[model samples]
Target: MESGVKKLKKGEREFAITAGVFFVGLIIFLLAGWTVLPRLSYAEKVQPVEFRHAFHGEDVGITCDTCHFFYKDGSWAGIPKMEICVDCHVYLLGQSPEEKKFVHEYVLKNRHVKWGLYFRQPECVSFSHSSHVRMAKVACETCHGPQGLSKKPTEYRTNRITKYSFVVYGAEAPSNNYGGLKKEKSVWGTIRMDECADCHRSRGKSTACFLCHK
Candidate 1:
């Protein structure tokens, strides 16, 4: 009877250990789900034209201002027109499938590719590229992330809840935070009104509604 009781207690202890481990694993799984599941709600829109920014920015050394320029009147020339792409892609530059696709669809047809803008702001909001880039000397990568080194075309993902591009919430997000690469959270990294407020607060600038709203 003593031996049987000892064996039963040992089995109970083993069961308790297994249950403890399972609960711990379950807690970690739930936390990970909470952090990552929200991002899956984004509707992914593939770009019609697959242009490599790294090919232009890194390999060819084309700067952001080369295509994205600011007028003297402070108006931002955000996306480059087909004329800019046509300069180099006038003829098939390579035997790659992407090049052929671009040449056949856009260049040959003379139809402008409707490239989706990832960081598009609302009409009511007034954002000055000149104010950020030329005046403040802010790096393009600061807002746009490391597009300069991107080998693939942009994946335009829009959050269903916000109807805004996922890029607006800082392109390299939860991954950056989880990897210990970024100390600040995505809420602070995003280029939303809150992000602007934080920057203004840091710089001692005003956060009046009229300052951003037009």
Candidate 2:
């Protein structure tokens, strides 16, 4: 009986040691996570031109539609061509180095700025900007976030799992109960099919798959 009692104590000590080690390891993992994990998860790329929408929209009073125009055939403009820039930037408008580079390289050469688009829906999806913009009168900020107020170009984050630009998910807030952008300031950061379904259902719009998918 004494030997059995001793073995029981030994087993308990071993178990306690194992539990303590595991707890310590977990704490270490969590501590390292604060700094290390984010770097591992995110990929970064620098944009060629550091464009400021705030300078254009807020300061210059340029509207979103001025640059992202919609066509008569219902397609929304992607990127403004060099000709559009030449209309205003034929001469150096600002003393900024970027403006000078823009005038010298792109404007003078009549070359288009290769702006990288953040939201690139899958080929199966066919989004209509005209229907959303003209008919529904949805503001550009609803989906694109407050990019108009953004002072600097932000580095786009791409989710490794979804393979979609994190901007699509991160840019827009979650749907409010009344079918508009979230006002409570929560960034759930994903525009999934379910989110779209919820928005459509809230607005009493048809949630037909064919409406989104080609």
Candidate 3:
């Protein structure tokens, strides 16, 4: 009778250990599904843009501020107006005939260039441009990556299915990452939460949930 009781307890212990392992594995599988998989939007499909940033940034020596102008303050002067390009044609720097035709037809004719923004702050975010640009005196290249180096205009490719646009970096969606790199000058990258965290932490400011989410 004593031996049988001991044997029953040992079997129960083995069964309990097996159950614990199974439970732990199940929890890990669910966690991965929640964090890693959804990091990418399912709606997004890859779009191909022929323009290469490495060629422009390294070879052409174009500064990022040419397009992304920043004032003396910390606030950024958002997208450039058409007036900036009134004097310059896309063909200014070794542009091909195709570029000339496109520019003459669209930008020259007063049609707006429809470059999609990848890094968009939420409307509710209430970000001030003057503070970050004029007050903070942040560099244009600090947030917006350099673009002046490209010899020709980049081809615009949008994923109709995912509604995401791709540049040299990955999708230019607000939620999309600023490529995996740390600095703006790093090879094509996305903006990630870590970047925001670093900025806020370094400044000793609290980026409250209310400050970011709508």
Predicted structure 3: lDDT: 0.52
Q: Rate the local accuracy (lDDT) of all candidates.
A: 0.70, 0.67, 0.52
Better of 2 and 3 by TM-score: 2
Off by over 4 Å in 2: 1-8, 31-35, 167-190
Winner by lDDT between candidate 2 and candidate 1:
1
Kindly report which residue pairs in candidate 1 clash with one another.
none
Candidate No. with top TM-score: 2
Q: Give per-residue lDDT, candidate 3, residue 72.
A: 69
For every model shown, what is its TM-score relative to the native structure?
A: 0.72, 0.77, 0.49
Sorted on lDDT, highest at the top, how do the candidates line up? Answer: 1, 2, 3
lDDT of 1 by residue, 123-207 (tens): 8889878877777777876667666655656565666777666432234333212221124323212356766788778877778
In candidate 2, position 212 carries an lDDT of 94
Residues forming the 10-long window of minimal summed lDDT in candidate 2: 173-182
Q: lDDT tens string, model 2, 59-141?
A: 88887777779788988877787677677888988878888887888888877787766666778888888888899987776
Candidate 3 lands at a TM-score of 0.49
Model 3 lDDT per residue over 33-114, tens place: 7765544433232222233454445766555566567666555666666666554554445555544654676666778665
Whichever of 1 and 3 has more TM-score, that candidate is: 1
